[model samples]
Target: MPPLPSHEYHVGIICALHIEMAAMRAMLDEEHGTFSKKAIHDHNTYFGGQIHNHNVVIACLPAGIDGVVAAGTVAKDMSRTFEQLRFGLLVGTGAGIPNLEAGVDVRLGDVVVSRPSGVYGGVVQYYRGKSKAGGMWEPKGMLNAPPVVLLTALQSLQAEYELEDSRMPSYLAKMLERRPKMRSMGYARPEMDKDVLYLAAYHHVVGRTTCDACEVAQTLARPPRVSTDPQIHYGVIASGDRVVNDAVTRDRLRQDYGALCVEMEAAGLMNDFPCLVIRGICGYADSHKNENWRRYGAATAAAYAKELLLHASIEETSQEKPVQQILGKSSETTRSEQDWAEQFFSKKQVTFQ
Candidate 1:
């Protein structure tokens, strides 16, 4: 089939880093390349492709420029260039906030899916709202939920998993096999012994890969899994700009919002685009964070996203309103954003072709 036009794509996949975007690029069944003509105002360099039966567009934030503001800008540029984009999937890595008593034992390489579980929507801006007496943000995270088609497909996929096993294991392995260099980049799972959860009181020694130098007995012990396959956790994901490398703040997010996962970019796009967030656990939100698991985490998240989109109903997704139309932004906000973009381009001396 000939390549579809830019307007034909409804699904948009975004990543915070190049590592994450590489996995997304590998998921495309048929890559249509980029648009021959792009809007003058849209500066994003999008990769066009097909996944299952759906045509999709993918993009990643520039290097060293990530977090809420950058993520929001990427999504907005996409909606303008690909006018029919119905929703998005922010697929990347996150910090696991493990709470044994609360039954959320998120380990490195595990995938965390954002879905509405309580008062908050699927993604929560944990940094918002006023502080309560004990210092928890008031439950003012009334954010937008993911589009219904994606949620319905998730329900079906979850039910299917109960009767059978997930394809994540095979998918991840296949990615490494097909793209062998990925293994060298730490996309392959590390040894089970490498997955450690040091006690909250213990801090990192710095300039080291693991906390083995710390008190070994201070690590949190849990039951061993039957297999090396990555497990999926469905729960709320807390989003903020601050890099969470401290245990106190990580536990605080869990105690207050029941956030099984914490990430940096989801909250910025969630309110405007109302998309689902898929993240692979790179480390526990603590000072022990390292680069060891980042590649593997990004890979796992991409695998789950591909599976989720395959199960989604194309008919239902096509029927959903376009993201630009659904954003619900006021005219004043729109004008303000336009003015800012204009000033930004002017200062940078961006000349249109």
Candidate 2:
């Protein structure tokens, strides 16, 4: 076993779900020929590749793993092996906040980027708080904002989008051409006519396969967005361990913390590493959830992430020390990431020529 060729990874993309990981992998321009060795004590796996001239790495969480502790563990290990990592991205899908007010008509499949607005940081942990009786809860701590380079890129991208529609669709189409699984109907974008915005009080029928059990008469009507492109919304994003599937709770959290989206893994990475969260809106944060649009949502987020990397000019920062200096050992001497994958599940290993 040997350490990688003293090279630094320009960026790392972290995803909690396989669908999201596949989307990120699809954007790789060239996969590294060598397989990465997993850190001795960690269970996470890593894939090496290049995207837009920068060496990039993508890491996926283990099965049934979706929370702060799990995401933080992967982020820490990734830093040790990929010492040259300047910044990271929590790229995945999240539930969208369906508030049609103040000129923000965020819809399903839209991209939500975490950005510091007012009192809240870009990412907020909804469960990191002291709960009291009478439904009173106080937030505990603040999460770290994204690195300066990434933030600058986001600002520039936002300015560009304001002038024109998002370019995610084209990028997504190209990526899908390479990775057909992502374009399957299960992961593919569903029809816009199927996009439903039910009333807050309307509850999804239990043990039903489709939304037919619920009354369409109770749906909410709102003006169609001027642009059908996946709009980008910048603001706080609520993260917690629990899956928020209730509209009442989702709206309350959005209003209380000014969260534009609700997700699960960003809280883990933000405190430990300086990274940005880019979430593709899969569905409304309500009970009528399904996987019809998950694939497309994840692809949109991944495409946006790649676009952001194009704006990042690698900074020669002094803070980055090699893994040998930080972890006291060569990462290559450890078990291979493929070995870890074999122990749990059987998925085809992504290889480079």
Query: What shift in Å separates residue 195 of candidate 2 from its native position after superposition?
Result: 1.2
lDDT of 2 at 322: 33
lDDT by candidate, in order shown:
0.81, 0.74
Give per-residue CA lDDT, model 1, range 194-222, as digits (tens). Answer: 88898877888767765667677878889
Best by TM-score: 1
Model 1 weakest lDDT span, ten residues long: 344-353
TM-scores of the candidates in the order shown: 0.90, 0.85
Q: Write the per-residue lDDT of candidate 2 for residues 1-353, one digit (tens) a residue.
A: 22244255657789999888888888877776444565567566777787777777788888887777688778887776666677788999998986677667778888999999787779987655554565555666677777677788888887777796666777877876776765564656777867888997787888887797789898888877665668788899998655777787777777668788988788777766778999999888788865677877898898899887776655533243332243322212123332432421222121110
CA displacement after TM-score superposition, residue 308 of candidate 2 (Å):
0.8
